[model samples]
Target: MPPCQSSQSFALDAIDSLVRCGVLITEENPEAAPVCDFWKKKGSLKWTTTDDPYHSDSDCEEQDLCSYKISQPSRCPDMLFFLCSMLAGHLRTLCWATMALDLMNTPLAEAEFVRQIHSHLWNTANQKKQYYESCSEEAAHTAVRTLIDLGVLLEERQTGGVFLGVSPLFQLSENRQKLHYFITQYLYS
Candidate 1:
């Protein structure tokens, strides 16, 4: 939920987003059963019976319903969407996420985020100071505005330029949890 510290550190990769979101488990776990009849419906996720070797210690031996590690194998693009949804769902618990993605297929909305990335491509050192100086608040405003429109980032003030926080579920990824803590416990606390 913490504002991307700087553009360089921000990742727009959706696959990375999935990995960050932890493709291990999600609310839709129950929907992936093989004989459950519900998921067997057309357009439902194609899931086959599986025996997960990676169920955590928290798993129940008796009706261990989470055999998802098999249905949605790792390194697949289709799994990214599901994982992203789950991560997005978890993030919603804390706050709406306003990510500045550097997407491979799509474009980033914020000019400042993009420009900052360009600066990184040109010069990696002192990137933060340079980005702040060269980047425009207007771009951040535009990006934030677009995100609010897309439901990715929510605006704290409709007339101003202060961004709140991203979803806390993003913390399931690498530094996301610490970033959330930094925002809630330190920065905004």
Candidate 2:
């Protein structure tokens, strides 16, 4: 399988594991164990982690199989730090991230945004139904809005068209790190 397919596979396996086991453990600090051990063991995905002991506070559990509750202690507080991929199963955000990375540090135009994303998804996954075929203009807009709300993307309105790129709200170094981490965690798993 391709790299992108492998990542999505890992993500699917993670969802399956959580649904089956009802729990996933982690360390108190997110940086200590960025990826949960349950995912590693279940998906056989080589996710990086520190040799830190798991703490009670990091024990995120599913309150009920019927629905997910944010109030549950098993939902780690550090999860709030995760990007769109972690919180949502949608692939649009990952597509946007892929487009930005393809720009090689340049800005992307909003006019042809969906096409760019579609091309990236197609090239990476080599699948029609799951990648390019599933992408839509509405999904792209929703993904952009999600990133904008999270302060990860900036939208610029010009005379002819709009542009999208890393938000100026963060320092250059911080922006680079955040983008790198987001892509690495989701697309490269």
Candidate 3:
């Protein structure tokens, strides 16, 4: 599979973690079939069978389930979009991404890398520039360290601060496709 597939899986995994942790729940039916006794009649808490639309169903038992209410219907998509936006911001900050386009496999200088990233953030897409830069310089540094940890980037020996592209997945030709795939996987998977 393409490296982007992995990236997509990573994105999906992150989102799934939120869902699994109960930070977000499906809007349509938070409790399709009561999985706990909280929703049904208890010592002082009395709930009629009519309280649940699924309670009377012959094929299903809705009692003994938690009828938790979830207010946000757009949470899944909204969170996914936010996740992508944040990732795009971080990727744009990683100027070494250009090395992905260099067929010659040239390493980018650290100073040049920062300069290029600044130019991209300061000039391109004026509306988002500020928001993109909201990520602290320290955060960018941490992101770079993460890339290196993930084997996506390589540290140069000649220039201690310089970095080289070690993975082709970041190439311009594959960047968008990878990002799209990542988002799609996160939304569907």
Candidate 4:
């Protein structure tokens, strides 16, 4: 039987191979245009350039990229957790309003849920004067769709109507606590 490799190790190996092939250029590669562009756009990838001059060129004053260190696996958060946290940050009002509804205990009709989010945003904007006008119904719909895409919310259809509730992923106590923390921190702080 083939050796069983953990997903993390497998992913790291694949990334290393890409890096070797110049497909996933690290900050260290001499030709790092793509990585530099990515850094400029996202500023998410960590990199550092050393002051030491390149051995091949004496006239060019560019710092050496070879010394840059790759980000360690231990320092990286789980992808799903990171995505959820980012989503909560981006949709703070929607996340807060949804959690306030306590969807786990009482699922709401889809329209009612969207209405609640719209109303919450309207009231919040009015109180904070954060916006000249209230958020539109389309924005509320998009937020709901995003939540569904992230598996944070689930949709169900009964004979009477379609209802929305917290997904099984968030129904777990641990996940629920983490999500609650993110939502509250983003919305209140």
Q: What is the C-alpha RMSD of each candidate to the true structure, in Å?
A: 16.4, 14.6, 16.4, 16.3
TM-score of each: 0.21, 0.39, 0.37, 0.43
- Candidate no. 3 TM-score: 0.37
Ranking by lDDT: 4, 2, 3, 1
Displacement of the residue 178 alpha carbon in candidate 4, Å: 2.9
Q: What is the TM-score (0 to 1) of candidate 4?
A: 0.43
Give me the displacement of residue 102 in model 2, in angstroms: 4.8
What is the lDDT of every predicted structure here?
Answer: 0.35, 0.46, 0.43, 0.54
Q: Tell me the tens digit of each residue's lDDT in model 4 across 1-189.
A: 227875434544555564554343455456543321233233332233223344222244444444222332343535435554555434665554555445335478899888877777666667777642336667678767767654567899998699888775556655655655645553323
The parts of candidate 1 lying over 4 Å away from their true place are: 1-134, 156-163, 168-171, 174-189
Tell me the deviation in Å of residue 53 in model 3: 39
User: Which 10 consecutive positions of candidate 4 have the poorest summed lDDT?
Assistant: 34-43
> Candidate 1 — worst ten consecutive residues by lDDT sum?
96-105
Two-way lDDT contest, 1 vs 4, winner: 4
Pairs of colliding residues, candidate 3: 8-182, 34-65, 35-65, 36-64, 36-65
Candidate 2 stretches with Cα past 4 Å from truth are 1-88, 91-99, 102-105, 127-137, 169-189
Candidate 4 local Cα displacement, residue 105, angstroms? 5.3
Best by lDDT: 4
lDDT of 3 at 22: 53
* lDDT: worst 10-residue window of model 3: 35-44
Give residue 29's error in model 1 in angstroms: 16
In candidate 4, list every pair of residues with a backbone clash.
Answer: none
